[model samples]
Target: MARATVQDVAKTAGVSVGTVSRVLNGSAAVSASSKEKVTGAIRQLNYRPLASARDLRRDRTMRILALAKNLDSPIISEAFRGVGDAAALSGYVSLIAPTAGDLEREQQLVDILRNGSVDGLVMFSPTMPDDDIEALATQLSVVQVCEIADSEAAFGVSIDDRQAAFDITRHLIETGSRRLAMIGHRAARSGRLREEGFREATAKAALLPEQTLFADGDFDFHAGRRLTRELLKMDPLPDAVFCGSDTVAAGCVREITGAGFRVPEDIAVAGFDDSIQAEMCVPELTTIRQPAYEMGRLAFEALFERMTEPGASRRGRTFLPHELVVRDSTKGEAKA
Candidate 1:
C-alpha cells in the first residue's frame, strides 16, 4: 500500500492543505471544528507523520504575496516592481494578487497566508479594516503599503499624504490661486488626509469657507469629469482645483478645456500621485510624486524583517518622502 500524503488526508478531512498542516504543526489559529475534522482524517487515513517531512513542512516558503486593488496603475506597478526587486535581493520571489475590492476574497488570501503558502504578505491599499489587519499581523508576517489603516500595531510604508497635499495646495496659493476647490474621494485614508491638508491650506490663506469648495467621488478620471461639471455649475467657479490623483486631474483638465477654459489661466489644476497621466496631459500636471517604488521596497523589507524575526517588536509604519512637481497645469507663469 502507498503511503498517504498530506493531500490525501486533506481530501479525506474536507479541509485545505494548509489547514491540515496547521493541525499537524499545532497552530492555534485553526478552528476547533476544523481541527477535530483534520485529526479524524489523519486517524482514518492511518497517516503517520515523519519527523523529517514535518521539519520540511515547517520550513519557510521564501515567497511573498502582494495584495493590491488593481495592478493597472503605473504608480501601483512601480511599487510592485520595487517589492519584486527588494524581495529578489533577499533570494525571495514576490507575487501580486488583486483583491478586486472584495472583502471575502481578501479574507481568503489571509487564510492562504496562514496556510504557509507565503513567508509574508504585503498589502497595498487594503480593503480590510485596521483591527482585522492588526490581528493578522500578530499571527503572520504582514506589512501595508500606501493607503494604510491607522494602527501602530500594523506595520506599513507610505508618504506623508497630508503634508504632500498641503505643499501642493500652498503652491497653488502662492501661484495666485485663491478661489479653491478639492475633488477627492472619502473612501481611502489617504484621500481624507489630503482633503484635511487642502482645507488647512485654504483656511490658513484666509479663504472664506464658501470660497473653499469640496466634492467627494472616486479617485478616477470619470469621477473627476463628473464632479468638475458640477463644480463649474456653481455661481462662481473655483480658480484652482486639487484632484485626489493624476487620473482624476486629467479628467478635470479635459472637462475644463472642453468648456473653453484654459488650464492655470482659467482654472489651475493639481493632482496627487505624479503618475504617467500627469505628463500625458497637454500642458502637463502639477502633482505630488509619491515614493511608490521605495515604499514597496521598504514594505517588503519590513515584512521580511518580521518573518525572519517573528519575536521582534513591531516596528510600526515608515513614512517615505513626497516631492511636489510644478507643471503648466498649476503654474501658468514662472513664480519668483
Candidate 2:
C-alpha cells in the first residue's frame, strides 16, 4: 500500500539507494550493470518515482499547466478535458488557469504559470500577441488551441474555420438566399478566419458585394441578437444570415423572431459549431459541427508532444474537419 521508495528498489535490486537514484536521474556515472539491475527492479515492482525523485534526478518538478479562455465556455472546457486526459495517460497531472478570455489576464497568467508552477503550458484561445508567445516558448513548452495563430510560433490543433465558414455560406446561397449577411466576432483567430472564408466566398460569386453584409460582434448569443437586429434594420434585410459561430446565430434568431420575421420564410439564419445549445434553440439551429471532443483530445496531444520533446519544430497545423448540420432554423430539413 505504500509507495515504492528508493530504499525499497535498492533492497530488491541488490544495489545501494545512491545507485538507484543515479539510474533514475540518468547519470552516466552509474555502472551499466548497476543501472540494468535497478531498472529491472523498477519494472518488476512497478515502482513510480516520487515528485521528489524528479527533483533529484532531473533537478526539476513534474507538473503540467493548462490555460484556457474560460472553463465555462463549452468549447474551451472540452479543450481542457483533452489536455487533462492526455496528461493523465502520460503519467503527469495538469493544473488549469481559466483566463476568462482576457488578453491582459492571459499574458499575466502565462507569466505567472510558466514559472516553477508547471513545466509547460497548454494554452487555449489565447489573446496574447505573437511576440509574447514566441518569447514564452524559449523558456518552456507551449501548445495553443482554437485560435488560428502564427503556425510557425506554436503547435496548434483546431477545426478548419475558413472552410467551415465557406461551406456554410455557400449552402445558404444555394438554398434560395442570394442576399446574405454574416455576423461574427473579430477579436479572435477562429472568428476572423470564418469571416475571411465568408467574405472570400461571397466575392467569388460576384453577386453584389454589398449584398453580403458583414457585422463585427462577439461569439455570444447577445452578439448574434445585436447583429441580427442591425441587419433587419438595413434598408433591404438580408434574405439569409450566416453566423460566424452557432451562439451568435441563435441570438440573431431570437431578435429576428421578435421583429416579426419568420425564420427560413422571411429571413433564414444559420450558425456554426453545432454546440449542444444549437439543438436547444426553438428551431434547432442549422450550424457547423466543429468536433468539440476531438479538438480537446488533440490539443492535449499537441501539448504533450511539446512537453516531452521541446523545440520539436512543431509548426504543425492540425485541422479537424467540420460538418454542416441543417435543421428547422435553416430550411425545415428532412433530417431534423
Candidate 3:
C-alpha cells in the first residue's frame, strides 16, 4: 500500500492544497467545515505528517516544552497530562522538564529554548522574575500555568488563587472561627495571593491583628507539621488553621491529633488544592478545588495559538473557576 500525503488529503477532502495546509497549521482563517473535512480525510487515510520534514520547511520543531519546579506535584502532573493530551490532538509533542527551583538553571533552559529547541514553552509555578519572562516572550512563545507572573507580554492560565483562598477562609469565619492562622510559603506568587486572601477574610471579620497569625515556609508536609506545632504552642491557639496545600494540611492534622486535640472541636483545619492527601487525612480536609487539568489544556492552547499566529497578542491571564469543598476537617455550620 502507498503512504498517504498532504496532496492526497487535499484530494480526499475535496479541498485545495492551501486549505489543507491552513488546517494543518492551525490557522484561524480555516473554516470549521473545511477543518472538519480535512481532519476526517486525515483519519480515513491514516495520514501522519512527517513532523521533522514539516518542521524543517516551516522552521518549527513541532514540539513544546513544559518547565516546572518538580514533576512530583499532583497539580502540576495533572496539568502536564492536559498539555500532553491537547498536543496529541494538535499533532505536536509535549515534553516536561523540571527546573528544581533554580533560577539560573531555568534561565539556562530558557536560553536553549530560545535557540529553537522547541516551538514554545509552558511554565508551571515558575520562579523566574516577571521581567525575565517578559523578555523571553519577546523571542519565544511563552505561557505560564498555575503560578503566573505579572507580565503583560506573556500569556497565562490559572484559577483565581486569591479569590479561592478568600472563599475558603470566609467559610471558616462564618463557622465561628474567630482566631484564624494561615500556613503558607511566601516564596511563590500563589502562596502570597492566598495569604492576602486569608488576611482579607480575617480583617473583614474585625479580628485583631494578633488574633490572625501567620507562619511562612515551604509548601510541604514537614513545614506544616513544624509550623503548626509552633502555632499550637502560642497562648490562645488559633481556632482555625488554613494550610497552603493538602500535603501541608495533612501534617497539620497529624500534629493537632497527636497533641490530643480533635479537629473542628479543638481547632478547625482547612487546606488548598483538594489533592488526594485531603481525603487520606483522618478527618477529610475542607479545601479549594483548583481546575488544574483545565488550566493545563488552556495553557497549551494559548501556546499553540502564539506559535501559529505570531502577530496575535495573547497577553494577560485566562482565569478558571474554583470550587470550595467543605469536609470534616473544618467545623462549619453547614456542609457545602
Off by over 4 Å in 1: 1-58, 332-336
Task: List, residue by residue over 1-336, the lDDT tens digit for candidate 2.
Answer: 855655678999999866876687677999889988999999988897533334422744456777777665667766677666545544467788878878887777777555666667777777778777777765667777777567465777888898899888887877778899988878888888988989888887777877888999887888888778788889888889988777787788899999988988988889887787788887788888877766766666566556555554466578888888888887545345
List residue ranges in candidate 2 displaced over 4 A: 1-62, 311-313, 332-336
What does candidate 1's lDDT look like per residue over 253-330, in tens digits? 999999999998889999889899999997799999988988887777677668775666355778888988888898
Task: Give one clash count per candidate, in the order shown.
Answer: 0, 1, 0
Which numbered prediction scores highest in TM-score against the true structure? 3
- Give model 2 RMSD, 1 decimal: 9.9
Relative to the true structure, how large is the alpha-carbon lDDT of every model? 0.84, 0.76, 0.87
| Cα misplacement distance, residue 134 of candidate 3 (Å) | 0.8
After TM-score superposition, the amount by which residue 299's alpha carbon in candidate 2 deviates from its true location, in angstroms, is 2.0
Sort by lDDT, best first: what order?
3, 1, 2
Which model, 2 or 3, shows the larger lDDT?
A: 3
Q: What 10-residue stretch in candidate 3 is worst by lDDT?
A: 49-58
